[model samples]
Target: MSETATAEAAYYEHTLTHRPLDPVSRYTPHPGLAQITSKLLTLPAEIRARIYHHAFQGNRVAVTSVRGCYCGSVATGPYRDDLNWMLKLPRWGELSYEVRRAFIGEALWEIHCEKAFEAFVARFRYLSNGNDALLRQVRHIKVNVFEIIRESWLVETNVFGPALRSITFGPWQKGWTIDVPNAVESPDELSDEKLMVRVTHAINTKHGYGFLKEAWEKGRVQRGGWKALFLFPIRYHVKQKDGKKRWQMQTWRADLDEGVIEKDWKDVHLVQEATLD
Candidate 1:
């Protein structure tokens, strides 16, 4: 090596011991090493994901978990010598879910199960699309479900009452690669009748026939918060399943209200995505 260049390199390496750490390493990074670190968040997510993908060759498992009791599953009829009854996901759980949904509709949410963890959920996690924003926010991980829809147009339909398309689940850390169905030109190509059957089946499977009927009656997330068993706000529409229902997205207006109000009800659990190879 050239003397001037070698001396300069030696001096730079010597000074490195005295220099303090870079400031961009806090909220995003764990310090100490000269090697690659978390502060790499400064780079674009796509780029970082590519780096991770290349380095790991996609072998790393993305895991998450959520804790909450399935409301209907809890014991009710029996009791100890004292004759105590049991209830779960009461006012506190209901109110907490509603408040979170009302204020941050897009944010990922989970109902904390108070029941025994053995039979009920403790957490949920899924593969991330390299969306660091959600990974940073989600505190828990792990999942499963009642219904699985294969409709193309359903992707564009509102999750609650035909108000929005592309429902959001977890900004899961190491997110599951979900295959969200594509929007088709004609929903008629898909069977509306069959979809209804699945809906009925999913409801029955998750909640009993009796609870299903009650949810059908209440029919609104805000009002039906009480009806939510494992989840919140069971809703049912009496009108015939409109196969031709015009699609709509969630919106808010303040024509008279002092603050922004929810124009459409949203369900966090009911909406989901799948991983297709």
Candidate 2:
């Protein structure tokens, strides 16, 4: 071969053997590191649930009636220290739904009074902007039912009815005693439907017109009627074994017994007329 051609062939062989690395491939993440950075959605559902539960444990939201109006605020750091850290998670929007479900579903909502409960509902509606997605996630609520005389219309509202799974009826006075028996003496013996009837009867006896049958009628006449009668299929039991008779009522979404409620409604009206007479 000619000297010039020989030199050119040698240059071509060197170029072919020592090609520069692609810039993108050079910066690619390690396979192990990519596996280590797996997303929350990639984890098993049970594991993700545990993570969400741990992240929001011990968090609380207090809704109090201040000057006859309601104000809702998150508990301070001592009570909800995890809140800040949870909010600071990377790519918040990606996990917003799961995070919110965990946060609201687990937190205890302390509503100081009936007024506070009403205000909380109003504020929740306003914040929701006509969407009940956030509200529906609520599972627990504590409210003072000692002076709830006007009727618990809000509890049966379409937006709040199915959302609340637990309702606690507590005394307004700090040290007052509620002399009420457990509606559920034996869970295995009594069906949910029977427990609901017992609890409804107890509440009606305790606070006449509080969970009134007339409220259902009025509600039906309003813009949007209630979904069920008396937050049906509820199981009631007392809490705080140390002599504080705070009744905690747990409800399930089941078919309501309209025939029973209608009969009770008639009975309530007759009693009211007799009292007036």
Candidate 3:
């Protein structure tokens, strides 16, 4: 089998082992909560799923370090009251598995720094007691680029699990900068897209590539574990368009193939555009 196929097969196998409970089994209520739980479960599977999505949809969670301790909090989107009530329901343990699966699967987890990333992983391992079931449910993440660059061990670590479908590198604060090898322009002066292009190139430079290659060769990273690598940085700012100021964020997806970073702007996408206050 091709490497991509092999990696995909591994992921498929992993998913099967941690598949979420079906609606019928999931709705089986705990002792005291039978009335409400049974009523909800009696609904069609599709309806139950819709309810789960509505409660957790668009949830953006941020993981950051404060006073040297790592913590997570809701960064955006409403924290639905229904979801809160569900958590406090009788024998929540009986329903927590499916609820957590939906919540983590749908939320976008954002990690702010390298240390916070480490803390997040460590906390997950500690809380889950090394089981990757919860990690596998995490489908989306928005993290600092430095986390990936410094923690290249993630390339081989099972910490992220096989279900991670999207990894966005940044929404770096304006004016943040990084040193790029062989770059003539100052990072501060470059536009966000251009700066990200340089940063991507840095990842492919001899030193950067060498570290990744060393890790793979040393068996620290699984061979063909990753299918493809792309970094999407979210940039927020104000721009003058049509003689009016507007809030906008530009994003670019750069693919890394065979240790080379492909800098293509054709994939640039504008997100969260709105009027600036």
Top-scoring candidate (lDDT): 3
Better of 1 and 3 by lDDT: 3
Highest TM-score model number? 3
Which residue runs does candidate 1 get wrong by more than 4 Å? 1-105, 115-189, 205-213, 221-277
Q: Best to worst by lDDT, what's the order?
A: 3, 2, 1
Misplaced by over 4 Å in model 2 are: 1-39, 69-80, 90-92, 147-154, 161-163, 178-209, 212-277
lDDT tens per residue, model 1, 113-214 = 112222212221122243332223332221222122221011111112322211112111111111113224434322434334433443454321342244
- Total colliding residue pairs, candidate 1: 29
By TM-score rank, best first, the candidates go 3, 2, 1
Clashes per candidate, residues 3 or more apart or on different chains: 29, 0, 0
RMSD to truth, every model:
24.4, 26.6, 15.2
Name the candidate, 2 or 3, with the larger TM-score value: 3
Per-model TM values vs. the true structure: 0.22, 0.45, 0.48
Tens digit of per-residue lDDT, candidate 2, span 170-249? 33322222222553455442454564555455445654336444443444334243333332223246546585655553
Cα deviation at 87, candidate 1, in Å, is: 34
